[model samples]
Target: MEAHHSEIRILKEIAELLNEGTEINGLLSEVLAKLLHVTGLSSGWIFLVEPDGKHMLAAKENLPHALAYNDCEPMCTGDCWCLDRYNNGRLQKATNIIECKRIESALAMKREDTNGLTHHATIPLRAGNEKFGILNVGAPNKTHFEPEELALLESIAFQIGTALKRIKLIEVEQETALTAERNRLARDLHDSVSQLLFSLRLTARGGAEMTADKETKETFTYIQDLAQEALSEMRALIWQLRPRGLENGITSALLDYGQMLGLKVEPEVSGVISLPGKVEEALWRIGQEALANCKKHSGQEKVLLRLSMEAHQVEMLISDCGNGFYYDDKQGEIPTLGLQSMKKRAEHLKGQFKLKSSPDKGTTIQIIIPV
Candidate 1:
């Protein structure tokens, strides 16, 4: 009766380990140790079946196989006895398996060394529709495994197989969620900012052409200047809208990027500007974007930018001599996301912005950010 109760307790413990919420490695190790204790065996191993149904030794104790680990027990099928027994749907023992026909004729041990192991029992590990692997215990004693002991080991192998399946499902779910987030970011960038930049560029090109007209050349020049000024502002807006969190304060950052793009920026600050931190950040980003546009599209050699503070607000002014673009009130003209972002940022802080430019003349952007 005492022996019966002990087996029952060990079986329950194995079941709990298989179903536990802990990590997979921890649970498997506990299962292996408990199985050895329950069977009163000193040597054993767990085998994993590869996709091809070949048996690979995964875990072992008190003896060494090529693949044995406390943390990992990867196994391949077709070569090991444990895998063969799992495919045949039986928990089998081979105390002196060299005498069995299946072990002698079916296994390739006829050419391999036999002293590595003389006695071992193999139990099939099954979960759902598939046989995952095998559990094996061995000893020098030929009669070490009894009929009742083999039955108990099979039950433990079945439970472990189910745990592996659940782990794979969890990994798939996490991968799906990561893919979804990347897709959403791609869509947002294309729809909002990309379309606006394309339309704004067309509008600028039209203005540049009109400045070459004979009758209204001067008027077209003015329009061209305003268009370019607006272009720079729009570019500033897009940088702020960027999700990657580009960092720069309006004055110094503007100078840095301008230098990179083959332009000189002589920036000056005065009157101790004391705007809110985010407002300063937005203005700096706007200035940097404006400088970037000038290098890329303005056709200018040098720009002068100045920042100063008033009683209640801080102001920024950027001036550049560059080919100008005409301003049109066309209804279908697209807005650049960068400029929209700048406008939104300015409006958010209840600040004011002013832009000035022309074809032969220069361009200037003035922003007043409140404290």
Candidate 2:
């Protein structure tokens, strides 16, 4: 009866932590630390796995020196029995893993800093049919876990998994709300500021053409030029807020955008244009930045855009034939805000971004994103 009360206390504490509405990573770390303290475990870690089978080490606490070596590189990468079983649908509940492959590898490497740790308990974090990832807890010199201990871990895992689902749903709703707000703003700008600028340009042009005095005409012409520039900038801002032709596809939208900037976009597309919504959005934004850069700096009116899709990944290459500035790859420098934005968009989706350029050789940007 006393042990059962202790288990209930642990569950209540963990449930409170999960309900604290903290960010996922921080919350997981805190909960892991709390679980270890209350259960007298020495170490723990949490993995957040995506639908694509890629996993991230979301949290860890009290790792031994062997696994903690090199910033916990051992835990950060490669596969192990728990993850394999989780992916293969074999890890449905809390169970004792025969051994931790990562620690085993570290032992074989003769680092000899495991702190007497050999095995761990792996609990699958799941809310019904939805599987989030795995929770691993271990202690120094502990090779197995009791049934009641596993049961308690399983209950904690359930709370964590439900919290993850709730957080993800909230994020999706927030993203949807943001996109709607952006579209509304884009429409308002198009109907108000954009139209006002267009009218201003026309009025300035008429004033210039009707004036007889050279000074007055010159003043009017300057006003007209300023208005025209402002109108162009407003249009670019509107496009950025809510891309106009994105419904058709990224390629079509980019081609239209390039033409708007007075550049000829030569596009080569392989495979169908079907892609996940987020992936397509990222690619479109990156393409917009690349094309805008080409128009602003490349000194050429023509740019090359290539898109290829494979079974597991999508690649985009943007290049120009104009005068490219000197880019030193050794310095790992991103020269412009546009390039940085493109790189960030790619990386946010676990993609790769590459750029190449040299004086008089033009610039090339390549992006590869897994599907």
TM-score of every model? 0.44, 0.96
Q: How does candidate 1 fare on TM-score?
A: 0.44
Which lDDT values do the candidates have, in the order given?
0.60, 0.91
Model 1 lDDT vs. the true structure? 0.60
Q: lDDT per residue, candidate 1, 118-194, as tens digits?
A: 55666666677766666666655454566666666666666777777876567567755754565565566557655
Per lDDT, the best of the predicted structures is: 2
Model 2, C-alpha of 17: deviation from truth (Å): 1.4
Error of 1 at 73 (Å): 14
Per-residue lDDT tens digits of candidate 2, residues 1-371? 99989989999999998898648899899999999999999999999988778899999998999988788899888999999988988889999755899999998998788888899999999998999999999988898888888889999999999998888788778888988999999999999999999999999999999989999999999999999999999999889889988999889999999999999999999988788888998999999899998988999998999999987789999999889989887889899888999999999899999999998999999999988
Native RMSD of candidate 2 (Å): 1.5
